[model samples]
Target: MATAGKDTTDASGGPGNTATPAIRHSKPPVNHHRAPRAATYSTSILPFERSPNGNILAAFCRAAYWTQGRAVWGALTASGDTKHCYKMDHARRGRAIIINNETFHHDLYLGQRTGTDRDAENMESLLSELGFDITARKNCTAAEMKSMLVEAARESQGDADCFVCVILSHGDDGAVYGTDESVKVEDLVAPIKACKSLAGKPKLFFIQACRGKFVDGGVEVVDSKGKHGQDDEEEMESDEVAVQTIPVEADFLMAYSVAQGYYSWRNREQGSWFVQAVVKVVRDNWRRMDLLTMMTRVSHKVAYDFESNVPSNRFLHMKKQIPCITSMLTKDLYFTPKV
Candidate 1:
């Protein structure tokens, strides 16, 4: 089994410090949720100029073209092209399970995961709004977690369009902690993958936990606007479709809160940066973007918008994180609003 490591402490204690002998392993804390302060810099371009090239007409035309393109694509996808996208017209959206493990067993030596309830609450709200039937479990042991997941997988999914599992806990590379012990990430998802009823359906796993102990001291870069601005598939069909069997791993999307070998950051009063960004991005853009696209936005929000601010611990201060997405989805996934 993977060993748990020290993480951030509660609001009063410095990061990586435990009041007792047992090791506590949770996300490092960010004292605040706001962006870091930076010195203001002036840009060469005038504030009134809307376009980089200084051509109002050209900028207007480009904007119009992009809007038109998006409309066209939306129309196409809204028509339900099953060949390129998952069919989401089921009577029910899907079943969603959230496993939130906050406090751990004394023998486990893992620290209590502070603020995880916020993450769970946010996730529950988001998924519920998206039409998923939510099943929430808190502070489950490893056996209980495995049993619950297996039972969930076995539940009839014929009426459902997808499956979602969100885990908020302390973790190491490839494993997430239950209250009593660690469970392999793969083991957590294997039962779902083997669910015959959910074959060819999207199975999403959102994991908010540390993958390792490494910290990211983000690199600084000048804004391009200050320096003069600027900035920055496919399907197949077949007749006879001979005994088509989807790969056990197909349609699985695993979103990790942090890159491997790094600590994921969380706010003691709010939630993990990754989960908060996911809730915000999905709520804002799910109607217009595919799951992968929304996840990309989630990664961006977490990477650029959040940073650790543990002034009490120099090693944990100003730390950064980038979410990792592993997708084996065979088609575009859109969470179209329920009628």
Candidate 2:
């Protein structure tokens, strides 16, 4: 996130003007947490309840969606490779919210996620390497998630440059499993946006869950390293607002692992396709490529390189997935951690 990609105008890596990017689904309002919230890093355990619906492999690409913050958000870890990263203080990089829900009411849930913890572990390692102070938790209920987001935003000290949140759980389009129940993507955004402390700051949300129950049946094609759809330039839609006014919810970037209404893929032991692609791209091209470019590469990796090997015939068609990103950033973003 070295603010190097400010010039990006391509749909894949640019400041988009969509007033409110339309997502595949929406959730009911999350009643803002009224109680005094606990510090994000406290030793307190997450309160829990149980039962659910959502989907299979919805949490498959939670790590895959870890884009939307600084263009090279994780490049802080690659400081040995980038000279500019050493110019900024690494301690001020900011905070990240990592929610990995693996356990649920077995009788009521579809199935237990056997490999999600691996994704969470790998994610924490990558984020830490990149310089984020992480507030990680597991098996949280819907209410806790809402309260957590509000607190995360409110407690975000003004000195930090950005905020990040990653949710890895069972989900259905704009909704994710909260151990005992499901919550909407919009509900999560509303409270964080309501917090005045984080206004005007770049915030990113990376969601790894199923948007719907669909699969991509790929057609045979010769392999090539060519850019897939560079020529198609669609005009951006814009809406004017009052001058100098910052909407309560501006400067957010959302990176979803799989496209809406489709299944996400992950290995039982290695981790998710999206997460792996992101780590590889940012690690190898930290300075040469910006975060937006890395995210586009992530989509390409998931869409073309990986394929599912689930034994069931029902899962055969789930051989591919495409990552999605939506942004409302108004300025350039970078990850220039001080030496």
Candidate 3:
């Protein structure tokens, strides 16, 4: 869910031949419990099911939609802040398919004041009611996010199971922000390991954006009780649980919000904060929780519901912003459910 500017073109869009760059070397550490594995660590766990349309699983769209090998793709803000014309709908689940390329916030840059077309229509109605399949391309090109991940890895031909991509643009170190343009997430995830039908699956990339410099503090205040609003569970036991699946050399997971340089928050109005704390902890814990404990309860509610005041500005005023999770998940992915 990270995207900002634009410019790097390829796939006939012209300009340095759509840039592929190639930065593969970096996939060797993930044991994720061996279930058609693929390496990635720091806390990765995706593989949940249930929700064919009713009974419950609606909050964030998840009917499974084909989970055989998993297949999801997102390009979100290729280089557009907003032009708007979205799409996202899913309902299969047997083989896993969720793609909601969200693109909202069309033109402004750095100063942002609300425009990305209602933040790309609320990220296409919140990942299509949490199901995802937003029809693809709200703002694309890195040759269309590498030709839609090589056509969702050739329609997951070789039994595609796991491969997710979520980029919500506006970054720095390494790069991301394409809406007029700015690319390089290693040129759109190094061509998904030369897609042999997504080679060995398990290729997740859930980044939010901002990896530069903007600090006044680290942000880590805690002190809450209940009533004001509740959703407790501050670690009863599960602290670390990355199992590792394919990455003896294949699988991959890249979840980022900050920690390269720093600074990830966008609220010209109401968006950003690691994607509203990752869709409010996956719509209040996808049935119970397990995407690394719902992204560590969205990194502890974005480190205690955010704070970086500087209102009076005597010299700099407010800044503080902390949000980081560089996990490369390998296993222990309960996939959240079981309530």
lDDT by residue for model 1 over 92-199, one digit each (tens)?
988888888777666555666766788898898888767788888777777777887898888999989999999998877788877666788778888998899999
> Any runs in candidate 2 off by more than 4 Å, and if so which?
1-91, 224-249, 311-318
RMSD of every prediction = 14.9, 17.7, 19.3
Each prediction's total of clashing residue pairs, residues at least 3 apart in sequence or on different chains, is 2, 15, 87
Greater lDDT among 2 and 3 belongs to 2
Cand. 2 Cα-lDDT: 0.57
Error at 273, model 3, angstroms: 6.8
How far off is model 1, as Cα RMSD?
14.9
- Evaluate all candidate structures by whole-model CA lDDT and list the values in order: 0.70, 0.57, 0.43
Model 2: per-residue lDDT, tens digit, 1-339? 100111111122222121321212112223332333433663423221110222212222222333433335455455543433222333476778888765554433334444567777777766665667788877777777787788776784566667788888767777786666677788888867775656766787888776776676666678733222222111111111112212325678788888767766555455566677776776655444555667778778767766544333444422556788776766545554333
- What would the per-residue lDDT of candidate 3 be over residues 156-250, giving only the tens digit for each residue? 44432345566665556666654345566665666676666555345666666666654435433355311111121110000011121122234
Tell how far residue 130 is off in model 3, in angstroms. 22
Ranking by lDDT: 1, 2, 3
